[model samples]
Target: MADLTDRGTEVGPGEFAPWPLLTMHLGGHPLDQAQLQQLLAWELANPERAAAWGITPANGPGQLQERLDWLQALAPRHGDLPLPPAPLEQCLPLYWQLWLPLALTLKQARDELNRPLIQGVLGVQGTGKTTLTLILQHLLEGMGYRAVGLSIDDLYKTYRDRQQLVQADPRLRWRGPPGTHDIDLGLTTLAHIRTAAAGEAVALPRFDKSLHGGQGDRSDPEWVRDVDILLFEGWFLGARPIDPSGFDRAPAPILTEADRQFARDMNAQLATYLPLWDCLDRLMVLCPADYRLSKQWRKAAEHQMKALGKDGMSDAIIDEFVDYFWRALHPELFIDSLKRDGEHVDLVVEIDRDRIPRAIYSPALAMI
Candidate 1:
């Protein structure tokens, strides 16, 4: 009844602008004459980007006219959407052109299997994992399927629980890194979602980082029922443990012998997360072109927070904050394995400095 990608934009029935579908391609899939004409018309409107996307313009006036005719019949869906200001196809070109197709492919696999699907997304901070999950849940629902969103951050242990971690290792004063999560809770939640019958309720967990003067704590639970697909995302959702020997080299500054040992300890902690990782039907990664970009992104976010009158981390503190996770298992080491040769990961969405999808790798597309 409503536009699922709503971004606060509202239009009366039969009075909306055409959606800009410029960057996506049909991907060599067979198309009927009408569909081919639609593709040609799209190529004509956005000639420069079209060439980059590997589309060729029609050679003759006859074919061009047919394409023009198709655009005349092409229509945009109009209604209220979840994402404010505009529909996803209008606001997120990369999501419309790239990620949407990947969602459909995952959906097709879900259908063929005839079972609940749990898709895990891994990305560094500011890589837009949450935004991607929201868009995906919206897209999946638009395709007549039910989807839910979960985050590994939500599976964090309570404030008192994390106090125990602090006692065990003072280096773990913060809530992130491997040792802080409640792996048992995550496992139970995933299994429940997988087998939940229609109308069965499942309580989804939430964590509030702003609580306890930023020490963070679990908030309340949100319940949902009958989800066909579960879109689980986090900075370290699908990461695996690396060789203990890899820790000896230390990718970043390991200030002290204790820090190095803590790094090794975190790597070992990754093994406990394997059961949770195994629940994923498909794993996707959002890999930045340069891992160093995360530092800049994190700084920008903190600056914005301070501008809004909220306390923000200083540059020195941000480095320690960011490095704490890297010390566990550098994304370059863990996510790269998933990108290059990871059998578990089903798709890799490579992003550039601007956080745009530069490329998508999947077995279907065969970038691997």
Candidate 2:
């Protein structure tokens, strides 16, 4: 597979080198630098900014600095994090500006709920859900919480099951979409974690995308114990179904009559995932500056894979792959709908073309 964290090159206005903020050879401030100073100034300039983001409410003066200091002390251990070649220094600005705040917010949510908090993160291709969960787990661990990351992919139907599914509906040529997951399995695992006692074993389902000729299948369940927080993320995580009629005049990709039917069926399938979404204590979206960028991001990922001398889909294949998902659940309709429904969504982090967060605000607050 390509570098999971690779957001590829430019997608919107302004050019960006592939992951400009990531570096393996780390040398720079871990914290308390220009980025930190700028963030502090931004927060100070407008106290309401924190409230709008739905993070832990800022307390008296210097509380934010105290939080930063606490996070800074834990930053060094992350300096050489090898996943996708990101360094602590290079990621410091994002940490101080976006991620650390999210960690703090998760901690606050955990404190409110006696049971384990299941936080759902929804992001499209290259929005950094994988990296975000890993970093958030680290920061939450620093804050004295046992946080674990789980992907919706893990809940996929066994290969044999999916084979049967494809036979029924040829439209599902791939694993992702709403109907492919074992919703019951997800509900069971979450329920087990929510009520698991200290030191009690909780097994999370794992899926291997490389298995069965890339058809993907369930592997052994990973045993973890006493998880205080679960960061559940996926491409369409937490997406809710829309009215079937919405597909009548659907956008570009859903142009054909067959395409509209597939979309409508997917909208119905989304209803099955609601019980799983109900399992979440909080939901946040890592939205793109433009949903269309996902196509470009997928192509970048494929290009990176080929550069590594690994087999990858051609640009034409990549287009078909991404467009299929968009047809199933277009960001314009489903994800944007989530952004509008503040009652369910807790936070929205708008990521720019460079995979940098440009805005972080609550949906209700954004309306204001």
Candidate 3:
């Protein structure tokens, strides 16, 4: 049997911190009392939340446990262990409640469609989108399905093009906010991924943030063929244009007539990207409990970087940086309404300040 940490020996209790299953069998080992208890705990974690994810039907526990077992059997060898040393206490609930079920849901959807499934994920920075994508990619690949990740950041206009854009409109100093991406390029890439036959190579663009003194640029292309699932995610992905009148009583950082004008203009830019959103088969939103948590999280990160003697922005600068984005597309004006939108959005995973997901539900079903 393979050891949890590649030690080649059976791990005893207290070997892996926070991994409470100190005695549970692993590596295809049959279930013991500990394993059964953990499974029941996860299956009944939250009746409403589990049901929303389609994990609580009459026969759902049987099906759900199979998925959980699939995850447990795969964990020791899943490349997520032995190197980065993830504490099971911090990660296990999420793995059981979120990643396993989401991955299996995508697999079922892809199998039903008989073609590539494009999933759109929306979340601000520090919402665990990267971790989610990594686990999803490995799990699907382990099952022989090719799961590729394509971030909206990869679709930004070339550095030269963005320079020209900033020159024409000095207000556009940043790459986020609407009007920064190459919509035609994104359309072409998604179309090709959807139409390509098996064994056909599709070139996906990549970006390097370290280029041009920290202003990012397109670096290279990763070529892939016959993609089974495409994990498309971005800070603003799946965001749609809202009515401009909402900006009248806009939130702070959006004060002054100048800020209001910029907000309205960026709001208009969203309309041009509707075609890209149309390509998504399903959309999931990772919403923060309080949107201001982004600023706190950013400052905390910069402090850590500076502590290590790396260049970091000061708290005031972080405030300015975060506020600039809010002035462009305030989350209150966009995400707050989007989370309740049943027509467009499919899933909403609400997270607390600690960033652990608190609730999972389908806007459409909840509305019904």
TM-score of each: 0.77, 0.86, 0.88
lDDT of 1 by residue, 1-368 (tens): 11223231334786432233231322223345665566467445644333323335545235333333322222132233344354333444444445445556656778976978898888888787887787667666766788889999899999999988789778887787897899999998998988888788999888998898878899988999978888999998888877777766666666567777987888788889999998988888887898888888889878988999998889899998888777766876777777764467767778777676656555333541
TM-score for predicted model 1 compared with the true structure: 0.77
Clashing pairs in 3: none
User: In lDDT terms, which candidate is top?
Assistant: 3
Q: After superposition, how far is residue 105 of candidate 1 from its true place, in Å?
A: 1.8
In candidate 3, position 281 carries an lDDT of: 92
RMSD, candidate 1, Å? 8.3
330 in model 3: Cα distance from truth in Å?
Answer: 0.7
Candidate that would win on TM-score = 3
TM-score of 2: 0.86
Model 2, backbone clash pairs (residues 3+ apart or across chains), number: 0
Question: Candidate 2 on 1-368: residue-level lDDT in tens?
Answer: 11323233224766333222223112333433444454444564544446654434345235565665665567676754435566455555565557777887788789999779999999998777887888788778877999998999999999999999999988888999989999999999999999998899999999999988888789999999989999999999989989888899999789999999999999999899999999999999998889988888878877888999999899898888888998999888998899888888888888777777667778877677
Question: How much is 318 displaced in model 2, in angstroms?
Answer: 0.4
Q: Give the whole-model CA lDDT for all candidates, comma-separated.
A: 0.69, 0.78, 0.79
